[model samples]
Target: MSGVDLPGAIRLVRANNVRALDPAPAMFEGMLRGWEQQQRSRLLARKTINDRLSLVRRFAEFTGTYPWDWTPEDVEAYFATRLSRGEVVWSTVRGQQGDLEMFCAFIADRRYGWAKACLEEFGRAPVQVCHDWNTAQHVAEFEGRPGRRAFTYEELQTFFDAADDRVEQIRKKGRKGVLAAWRDSVLVKQFYAYGTRRRETSMLDLSDLRHNPRAPHYGRLGALQIRYGKASRGSPPKRRTVLTVPEVDWIVPVIQEWVEEVRCGFSPGRHPALWVSERCGRLGVRRLDEVFAAIREHADLPAELDLHCLRHTYITHLVEFGYPERFVQEQVGHAYASTTALYTWVSDEYRNRLIEDALQRRLERGGGGTLMPQ
Candidate 1:
C-alpha cells in the first residue's frame, strides 16, 4: 500500500470486513497512533514504537486470523508451535503471551461485540495464559536442565572481579577507553546492587540521582522519582524504590568521574539518562544483552547470566541475609510478594546453618538448644 493510501485502505478494510468487529485492528492501529503521538510528544522513544510494532506483527502472524476471530485455542496452538520449535520454556512463552493479551485487550475495547464473544469463549484468555505460563515457569525452575544454570555467590564474585580487572586494562588504554570501561563497570555493579530492571536502569537520567546537600561525604544515589518508571495505565501507580547504599556508593563515584573527567565540558541538557550509546543515543533493554555478552567475554564467565539475573541475585541475596519478605519486595519494586519470592532460592547449606545458629543462640538464651525437652 502507498503511504498516502494506507489510512484509506485501512478504513475500507475495516468497513468491509466482519472481523473488523473484533476491534483488534482498530485497537492495534490506535496503539500505533498512540505510540506515534507519544513519540511526537517526546514522551516515548521511537525505539519503543519499533519494538512494540515488531511484537504486534509477530502476534498477528501467529494468530493467523484477525483479532475478532482469536480463540483460546489459537493462543494454545501458538504456544504449542513455539514449543515444537524448541522454545518450550515458560518464560519466553509467557512474555509473548503478555504481548498478545495486551494486543487483544486493545482490540477488545473498541469492538464490544467481538470482545464479549471472545471473552465469553476464552473465559479470560489472557489471565488463564498468564496463570498457566507462571506455573510452567516454576516447574521449569524446579526441574533445572543442563542449559539453565543458576549462579552461585562465588561465581558472581568471580565475574565481578574479572570485570574489575578488565576495567583496569581499559584505563591503561587512555581517555576514551577509560571512560567506556568505567561506564560498563558502573552499569554492571548497579545492575547487581540495585537489582534494577534493565529498562528502569536504562531510563535513568542524571537528575535521577539525589545528592545529599547536608553531608559533604554523602554521595549521589540512583534514586528514581516515581514519575519515571514503567507504570500501568500511563501513570506512576507504584511507589519509588531507593537503591541500596552499596549501589549508591559504587555507582556515584564512577559516574562523577565520567562526567567530570571524561564527559568534561559536555552536557546533554537536562536529560539525566545515566547510560548512553555510541549510536542509539540512549540505552535501552535490547542493548543490555550486548553489554552482558561483552562482560561475559571479559570475565570468561558463562553466558547463562542475563541482565535480569542481577535483579534475581539481588533478591536471592536479600532473602538469604534474613531480610523480611516485605522489605525485599519494596526494594525490588515488586507488585506482589509472590513475584519477589520467585527469585529467592534457599540453599540447603544456608538452611542448616540457620538452624544451627538458631539452636546455639537459643542455648545461650537458656532455652536448652538442641537438648530441649520435647
Candidate 2:
C-alpha cells in the first residue's frame, strides 16, 4: 500500500520508501511519521505526541542505529548517560523510560507492520529493547522536593498581606505599577481560593464565572469553570466546576472587584480573559510564577515554596475546613479520592480537633463517662 493510504509504521511512499538515498535513516524517519499518525489516531494531545516522537529520535541518535537495530545495551547506555550527568531528577528517569518503551512497543507490534518491513529491508525485525529488568520501577508516589510544602496558615496570611500591601503602597505613591500590583494580589488569592494549577488559572476567562444555585450569596463568583484541567494521556483537557466553599468565600468580593472594576482598566476590549495583561491579552503561566515569586520573596516565605505550593495549601486548608474528601477531590479536579488525599497535610490544630471530636463521640456512646479508673 502507498504511504498516503497506509497509517503508522508500514507507510513507504514518503522518505520511508528510500528510492535513491540509503534506506536506514529514511526508514527511521518513516517510522517516526507512522508512530505520529498512530498516536494521533488515538487522539493524543499534539504536544504529548511531539514529545514522544522527539524522545524516540533522541534514542535513535544516541544509539547511532534505527529502531530495527536497537538492543537492550543501547537502552542501558542511554539511561546511564543521563543518570551519570545528573541531567534530570530521579522521577524524570521513569518518564523518559516510559516514552522510549511506548515507542519500541509501537514499532515491535506486528499489526503496525514495522517488524515485517524492517525484516524485508534489513534482514531483521524491530524488537522491544525496554524490558522489565532494564527499566526503572515506579516505587515512589510523591517525587516533589522535601522543601516544597504547604504554607502554614500564618505564612499564607503573610504572603497574602504582602501582596495586598504592594497594591496599596503602589496606589499611595501613585505608581504606574498600581494596576499590575492590584492584579497580582487578586491573582494570588484566586490561586489559593480556587485551588487551581498555574495553567488552569492562566486559562481562566470572564465567561467561565457562574453563579452556584446552592450559594446565591456569592453570586457570579460562586463557581469557576476550569476548562483546561490537566488531561490524561491521549485525552483532551479535562473540565470541572470548582464551587467556592465558605472557607474561601472571601474571594467573592475579590473576584467582583477584579471583574467589575480592575480588569477593565487593562483595556481588555474584546478579550474575555479573567486576567488581562498590559498588552490586553490573557496572562501566561510564566507570568503567574514570576508574580508569585515576587510576592513570596517580599513576604519572606520559603524559596522552595513555589506557585504550586499554593495549590497544596488550598487542598490542605479545604480539608481542614471540614469539606469531605470527595468534595475536595471534585473541587481540585482530582479523578481519585486518594490523589486528593495526597495533597492534604492537615495542620496540627485540625488533627487535634479530630482527636477531641472522636473522643467526644466515644463518650456519647459509652454512658458519657471517662474510661480511665480514678
Candidate 3:
C-alpha cells in the first residue's frame, strides 16, 4: 500500500469489501474512514464521534486487535474491567455498554457478509451484565446510606437564593467582571426558571424567543419554541413552551443588555448566536463550561450542581407544589412517565406533612376513634 495508491485502495475496500476473514489493517482503517464519513453525513456532531471513538479505542486495546475482532465475551470482559476500576454507577456502566453495542451494530451493518450471522446470534444476548454488576457495586458501596437524597424546601430555597445573590453581585460590577461570569449567571437563571437541559440551553438561538400575551399584569411570560431536542435532529418540528412570567422578566432584560452593551462590538449579521465568547468569535460547549465554572465559583454551591441540576431542581419544586406528574412530564419533554418520576424526590418531612393533613381532615369529618367509628 504505497502512499499514492493507499487512498484509492481504501476507498475501493470500503465500497466493495465485506468479509471479515483475513481482515487487513488497511481494511480496518478503510472501515473507520467509512464510519467517519457516515457519521458526518448523518449530522452526528464531533462530541458524539469522539465518544464513540473513545469506546472503540478502549475495545481495540483490550482485544489487541481492531473492534471488528470483538466478540460477545470481549464485550463482557471490557465492562468487567470497568467494574474492577471501581466504577460502580449502573447508569454510567450501562451507558458505556450501549455505546459499544451501537458501535457493534454499525460495524455489522458495514461488514454484513463477514459477520452478519455472528452479529445476529449475539444481538439478542442480554447486555445487562454490566448493569447488574454496577448495581451490585452501588448497593455494596452505599450499604448503610438511604436509597435517595431528597432536599428540603428550605435547602432548595437557600441554594436558589445564594445563586441569585451571586448573580446580582456579578451584574453590579458591570463590564469590570469577566464576560464568562455574566454568561453563566444568565444560564443559571435559565435553568432554574425554565428547567432547560444543558444541550437545549446551548442550542438556543435568539430567534427562539416570542412574546406571550397571557402573562400576568405585573410580569411578562415569553414563549420559546424548542425545535431541536434529544428525540430529534436538525432544528425543525419545534414544540412551544411557555416560560413563566418571572423567568421571561429576568431573561429579557439580561439579553437586551448583553446585545446592546456587552455585545455591542459584534455584528448581529455576522454572529447570530444568543451567547458569544469574549475571546473567540463563536460560542460553544467551552463557553458553556466557563459559564458553569463562574456559577460554581460565585454561588458556593456543591460541585454536583451542574447545569442539569437546575432542570432537576425545577422538576422537584413543581412536584412538591402538587403539580400533576403528567403535566410536568410534558413540560420537560420526557418520553416516559417513569423517567420523569425520577426527578420528583420529596423529602420525608413533606410526605409526613401530607399524611398529617389527611389525618386532620379525617378527624374534622367526625370519623371517630375506636368508640365512635361508623
Clashes per model (N, Cα, C within 3 A): 4, 0, 0
In model 2, what is the error at residue 54, expressed in angstroms?
1.7
Candidate 2 per-residue lDDT over residues 160-279, each given as its tens digit? 999999988888988798889999999999999999999999999888998999999889998999999999977789999999888778899988998999888899899989998999
lDDT of 3 by residue, 285-314 (tens): 665765665656565755655556666767
**What are the lDDT scores of the predictions, listed in order?**
0.60, 0.87, 0.58
Which pairs of residues have clashing backbones in candidate 2? none
Using all chains and alpha carbons, the TM-scores for the candidates as numbered come to: 0.66, 0.91, 0.69
Order by TM-score, highest first: 2, 3, 1
- Model 3 misplaced regions, further than 4 Å: 1-23, 34-50, 67-71, 86-88, 102-111, 116-175, 178-183, 216-220, 232-238, 245-271, 279-283, 369-374
- Report clash pairs, candidate 1: 23-107, 205-272, 205-273, 206-272
User: Cα deviation in Å at residue 293, candidate 2?
Assistant: 1.8
Off by over 4 Å in 2: 1-6, 12-18, 172-174, 360-374
Estimate, for each residue in 54-171, the C-alpha lDDT of model 1 and write its tens digit. Answer: 7667656887655555567777777787788986565756656665665455444423233444455445322223245432343443332345434578878787777777778776
Clashes by residue pair, model 3: none
Candidate 2: C-alpha RMSD to true structure equals 2.9
